[model samples]
Target chain A: MSPVVLWVGGLMLAAAAIIIVVRIERGPSMLDRTIALDMLVGVVIAALALWSAAAERTDLVNVLVVLSLVGFVGSVTLARFVAVEPEDEGRILTPEEVRAHDGRMRASLAKESKRRVGGREDAMRRAYPESEDPR
Target chain B: MSVLDWFASICFFLGCALNLIAAIGALRFPDLLSRMHAATKPQVLGLMLVMAGLAASLGSSQLTWKLTIVVLFQFMTAPVSAHMVGRSGYRTGKVREDLLVIDELTEDLDRAKSTPIPPSSS
Candidate 1:
């Protein structure tokens, strides 16, 4: 591998790392961060491969293997641990969804009140037969 | 540079480009599943390409074996890890259901949970 190709590859991997870091930092949920971290591992592996190739070093390949192992284990453990999280814990409902939910609840409550009022009117008519038999 | 060197360079550049694409997708994607999809697919492919380039450049029996090990391990682990992450994200409600066109996992889980447990053999 030429020095120029090595440097170019390194620069590209660096740029990728920067973007992945942003995702990890800004992720709204842990799983998003996990995905970012997993990608970061991949970027690191690519960087290592580039480095080993450029330097003509075989020793670093073992490091790639170890890193891959660690990345897999970390993601699997995290996934199993988080599999039972509450429905609302990691989810972020959009504003529109929240508004729609509120509207639905209000409508249901209004309907319940109307039904209750109708029942009350029927009970009142039964309690005061004279009021209903005004004929 | 020799033809092999040129080929290696091409592979390296292609791999780096793919890595960049994966990272950008990870940042720009709207939800966890999409992000996972972006993170895993291109990244693994990129790594393989870069590793192939590295192995070709090294050209020693020992280095070839080492790179082969790395590639094999990556191929085995990448999909499993991605599956784990996506599954966990879905289970934990980290994924956006609104963005999903299909959600068979939820249906399967509901069915499983609703069914009665069988007696343990132990």
Candidate 2:
């Protein structure tokens, strides 16, 4: 019964993690992706503990302990690398700057997006038979 | 299935569901810091539930004690990890002004802003 519960629980967590991965993939910036990575490690530890208990295996405890330490180290490294200004003293971004920067990136990204879509269509046309509509 | 098995399985399912909710919260939230809060809390609770279910199924004092050790350490350390990540996120310039809550870290940065730590020193 315990093992069954663990298996179900792990599967549920996995599904949730996949959703997080999507966010990571779609993140507009590096920091957004970093948070997702942090969450992923947390999920891993939880799943491990559940499995260890379900299996009646005390031997797996070490894995959780090691991961706990390792996850913190990894987060610290990322946070340090991605440090932001504290939101005070008028130093944080104003609306205009954000708009300007986003506009520039969007312009570039739009061109890329269009090019990729065009390429996909071209590939599709080549893969299909002549009788198939290119549309 | 035995009574013990049935109870454990149900609890395990509940824990898994809670964990998934936490992950969804982490992803669906608009900003990174908010996402961290969502990421940490529910996962710990979910893990606690999972460990308890494991103990029930295994039915060994020694194993239960070990499982408890892992859970205890995880709970204690998760906050530290969050803090480090938040600190680093701030240092590297990832703080989003549009969705921020408290500004305690700003004070921290101000206090330490004057003191320069050479990267190579570490």
| Position A12, candidate 2: lDDT | 84
Q: How accurate locally is residue A97 in candidate 2, as Cα lDDT from 0 to 100?
A: 86
Separate DockQ for every predicted complex: 0.51, 0.41
Q: Interface RMSD (C-alpha) of each candidate? A: 1.6, 2.5
Q: Per-residue lDDT for A95-128 in model 1, tens only?
A: 9998999999999999999999888888888888
Among the candidates, what TM-score does chain A have in each? 0.60, 0.55
All candidates' TM-scores?
Answer: 0.74, 0.64
Error of 2 at A95 (Å): 32
The whole-model lDDT of each prediction reads 0.81, 0.71
* CAPRI quality band, candidate 1: medium
Most lDDT-accurate candidate: 1
Question: Which residue pairs come into collision in candidate 1?
Answer: none
Q: Tell me the number of clashing residue pairs for each predicted model.
A: 0, 13
